[model samples]
Target: MINNTIVQELIHEIVKEEEGVPVVECLMEGSITDEEIAEKTHLKLNTVRKILYKLYDAGIASYKRSKDPETQWYTYTWKFESEKIEEIIKKRNQEIIENLREMLAFEENNMFFACKNGHYRYTFDEAAENNFRCPECQEELEYMDNSEIIQQLKRELSLYENNGSEIAFNFKSYS
Candidate 1:
């Protein structure tokens, strides 16, 4: 898709600004050698290679290796995979949504009580067995208001879901 905005954001999330600079520039170019990337990004060659390797390990980048015929120096040319980035972000967002949903379900289905003194939460059965008192401070337990927390989780979940849909995979070959 020849996109730089989304690729820059994704690289920034994966690496430091300095590291992300080269990665974003080179990645948008489809593919480039580490040396060229370093020169273009104004970074040290070793730094560029290290950052590229890290991205590759994360499956955000891929590379092809070749050897110079004369010097026999092995060189790797890398390309940032936009398709993989979208998949990673979407997967992570879905995982977060799942966790939030589980928490919301728990909060809605369970009756929770809290100690007025220490703010410790306990299930209804625990509170009742303890005579509606705080086990630690011996203070009276009150009904815990988790509505705000539930609402917040719901909002976050919705945001993630919405953001997940923002990226449309073009699946076009950069090469």
Candidate 2:
């Protein structure tokens, strides 16, 4: 039933696959002790604890601490917050969409010039201030056509807007 790829990738983001995925899987089973997680995942106790703490810090995992009365040692029981995980992903996607919108607006508003040597890019004001020459390479700056870039941003923005947060992530490491 753990079919959420976003949760999987979020865990992969919290720590390396060697540690993160297994720890997250164990936590998803229900509240579990670090020792139990290590035993189930076949990872070192310390490694499991580390991954758990990282997930905790990321707001997708939480732990309950209790004192073992006879042993006088603290025990921690950890659980994965599936709801919080989805919230984090949606917030991240919204941030990405906002950034893309800002980029599209800037692209639509600006006239850009770039050096032939590809050393610099400047807006109209900067290019005019420098006499349309590359300050770094002393090459004449040429008008840069950004139509393709604008089109690409538009396409990407449209995808996010239409699909909401359920679109596939381009997380190269996880995917």
Candidate 3:
């Protein structure tokens, strides 16, 4: 499932806001040069190289450097780590689940206070320390019912726990 949405989203996160999906799709065609990928994806060569480097840093892409005997110039042939993608996804999902659990626990254990504009949130101790006033707007802080937030976190945690182990692999090619 290299081209699937989950994989694409992961790549997007690694590469930031740039559109890395098309570049990833091109890499799934087997080992290829960055220039070839740029041409195939209609992306700027520099942008393609940047994405390749970022993916490499993230352990999702790798490259082999070759020296041309005639020109003595180096060329990089890049390959996507198709096998590692699923593992990366599982690890990241687990981290997210753990963070969600912590947040849920914090919400369950403490009361929250917020400003009228929702610009700030503080735990009971923090609110008390500040005399129940917003630091930014100087408005009186009011008790914020966080049951909805707690429920949302629980639902998200449940989804991740249920689906974290069943990531399917259907990559087109591996190198």
Candidate 4:
């Protein structure tokens, strides 16, 4: 199963193309020059450059460039920033938790009514004002039970809260 981090998914997709490639293995070791990465991975120089650029754009990779005095050529040393991936995972989980809070509040606050035809839903005030009739079907509007949905949201929020901290701790240790 895929984890929640976007970084993980992107890395997975890239590594899936070729197993035991140097682009990934060498970077995973530590900081490595692009040329070294290409040589070690047996991948074309252009392919290694493309991979580094892609990771750099995603903030999961970083590089430092230096000019060679003798050759007058620029050298770029790249490193995989595992910390950045952990940060992204935290951000994604936080956003998910915040959205869950907003949805739970909305679901728990309003009293909704739905028609027997299962069409549209309205708040209690709207249903009362509309004579408890469905706007489209004109049938009686009954109370909508949202407890199940609210419970589900609660469960999701709890999962994020509980898992986020543990994941952060393990990520730090691994880094």
Q: What is the lDDT of residue 24 in candidate 3?
A: 82
Candidates' TM-scores?
A: 0.80, 0.90, 0.79, 0.72
56-155 in candidate 1: lDDT tens per residue? 8779889999999999999888887767876776677688889989988988888989998876899899899999999798999999888998898899
Whole-model lDDT per candidate: 0.77, 0.81, 0.87, 0.79
User: Which regions of candidate 3 fall more than 4 Å away from where they truly are?
Assistant: 17-19, 113-121, 130-144, 168-175
Better of 2 and 4 by lDDT: 2
> Which number leads on lDDT?
3
State candidate 4's TM-score.
0.72
Of the two candidates 2 and 4, the one with more favorable TM-score, higher being better, is 2
**Global CA lDDT of candidate 2, please?**
0.81
What does the lDDT come to for candidate 1?
0.77
Q: Which stretches of candidate 1 lie over 4 Å from their true place?
A: 1-9, 16-18, 126-131, 169-175
Residue-level lDDT tens digits of model 2 in 61-133: 8999999999999999999886676567778778888999999999999999999998978999999999999
Poorest 10 consecutive residues by lDDT, candidate 2: 166-175
Clashing pairs in 1: none
lDDT for residue 69 in candidate 4, whole number 0-100: 100
Specify the poorest-scoring 10-residue window by lDDT in model 4: 1-10
Ranking by lDDT: 3, 2, 4, 1
Compute the lDDT of residue 4 as modeled in candidate 3.
Answer: 74
lDDT per residue for candidate 3 within 36-61, as digits (tens), equals 99899888899999999999998989
Per-residue lDDT of 86-155 in model 4, one digit per residue for the tens?
7777887899999999999999999999989989989899999999999898999999999999999999
